[model samples]
Target: MSSTIDESAYVEASNGQACLAFKDEKQEARFELGVSMMVYKWDALSIAVENGWGGPESAEKRDWVTAVIVDLFKSEKIVDVTLIEETLLYAMADEFDTNVEDDSALPIAAGIVEIYKQCDAQDFSTVEKLYLEWTEKQKNKEGKRIVQVEEDPLNPDASESEEEEEDVEFEIEDSMAVDEMTENNTEPVVDEDGFELVQKKGRRRNN
Candidate 1:
């Protein structure tokens, strides 16, 4: 879904400088949720997280990027497409060491701005469409991964050289690392203030 915004509606003067603010509390909440969905839907970010480019905490780092974007709406009033795009690019570079030179963040930024405009007008159709599309993509993604795993044969009786044993051990260690990183992962609880309330991290188990 594409859209353009009336910049005047979201910007207001605060201490003699322009800042972005939603029309009302309801609008703010909706816009925040939309931003979260948009962040998650970005493929560049998805690849970074899936590949653990930002380390085993890549997923949480992605959420942190989402929160940072949401905070821009909350704290800054003059946020524009350029600013949002910069933020995404910076997050990828800083957290994942990924340089997104293809300008992939532009559309996501535009989508976020469009979401803000739609929510400000009390029109949730765009947000709904995004949610539905994201859900479908996730389902298809999981299905494909399941198929790949099922098709890969695992034979316990197969003889392995030392190099093969090392590779298998590496895979096992990597899987354990990811599990360790995520074992304490908690679902974010968004409040009426359009911010996520994360639970305290759990104790890590010793291997």
Candidate 2:
């Protein structure tokens, strides 16, 4: 569902917070903090799930979730950090499938606040480390998938030949790469004003 911030939404500078009035797809008026909008919790959760957060170890899951939270906040265009701790508390509870009462949310909120404080202090190692770890995990997962595909039973015999063909195709495509070529390095060529030019060896040369 789509939600748009109302024109009347205003920010409170003292607390670095904004109370946004939003109308959802159903045209129902609801309020959320600017941090919630910045986090885009729904989208972040989907991305985390797709990246195998649910299958990782508890510590790994927590790290990935926190990284995503921080990344969301960093990616947003909003100036102030608002409702970040609250949003993260809710997101973590949802990720862990736990019931987080208002009282229980305090600790989670405190942790997020600490991270935010660290960020404001210009020390971003916490977020950076977690993001790099998560990225490595994704790369490893992709590598494993590729290996599995190459080892598939039905294609076992053809795998080697298929790989060779792929290598050849890759080489040909690489040779055709034009991004590094300058106009002066290539021969002068002209396009037909009203006629199609014959393509030979995947190259258009003047007839």
Candidate 3:
């Protein structure tokens, strides 16, 4: 989309080094490691998904992918993945109208960008905050989300169509198969296509 990407606040990156550099008149040494790794990985990950190199469900990799981008290259320090994630997640969450715990943790931006050319002002604001807060959170990893990720309820950064998917309503299960007599977790069943599901109590697919 219209460069949800932004110029660095205090850094720059030239060719031959896949990342952002620090502002130093003397020596000009950069935060090369984080920048290089983030740029390399993020670009590669995006390209891979765009090229259909992974499963539809493999889309889960996008969040892990976004985490690396903000954590390493975006003028942010290491250790803020959680808040950084929560920021992007919540932004996407608000658009989707569902908490992360309810839906799949995939990168919605790539999907949105796939559909629209630019994320409008309201949504761009969220992306802006995501970059800023991510940098702050990296400066302090153990911070909380209510304080770091959530922002004023007015502004947001995303595409108009992104607006459409916000609520992402779903009815995932009717009755789950329980462990007969033990306290434990049971994963869902996946038929050939990898969709996680269990048969609806008394309903079949067509009837």
Residue lDDT tens for model 3, 63-180: 3333343333334332222433354445333322334452232233332221111121122333333435545644664422121223325656666666556535432211102221
Candidate 1, residue 67: CA error in Å? 0.8
Task: Tell me which of candidates 1 and 2 scores higher on lDDT.
Answer: 1
TM-score of each: 0.65, 0.28, 0.19
How far residue 66's Cα lies from its native spot in candidate 1, in Å, is: 0.9
The parts of candidate 3 lying over 4 Å away from their true place are 1-72, 102-207
Over the stretch 1-207, how does candidate 1's per-residue lDDT look in tens digits? Answer: 535443322333356544565647666666766787888778898777766678877766776787788778767857777888899998899888999998778888888877776786789777767667765665554321111122124555545663365344111122212233457583445576434433223322222
Best by lDDT: 1
Candidate 1 wrong stretches, greater than 4 Å: 3-19, 143-207
* Best first by TM-score, ranked: 1, 2, 3
After superposition on all C-alphas, the RMSD of every candidate to the true structure, in Å, is 8.7, 19.9, 19.5
Order by lDDT, highest first: 1, 2, 3
User: Candidate 2 on 95-202: residue-level lDDT in tens?
Assistant: 655444444333333334444444444454544454355445445543211111223455546667775654441111111111112322854232332211111122
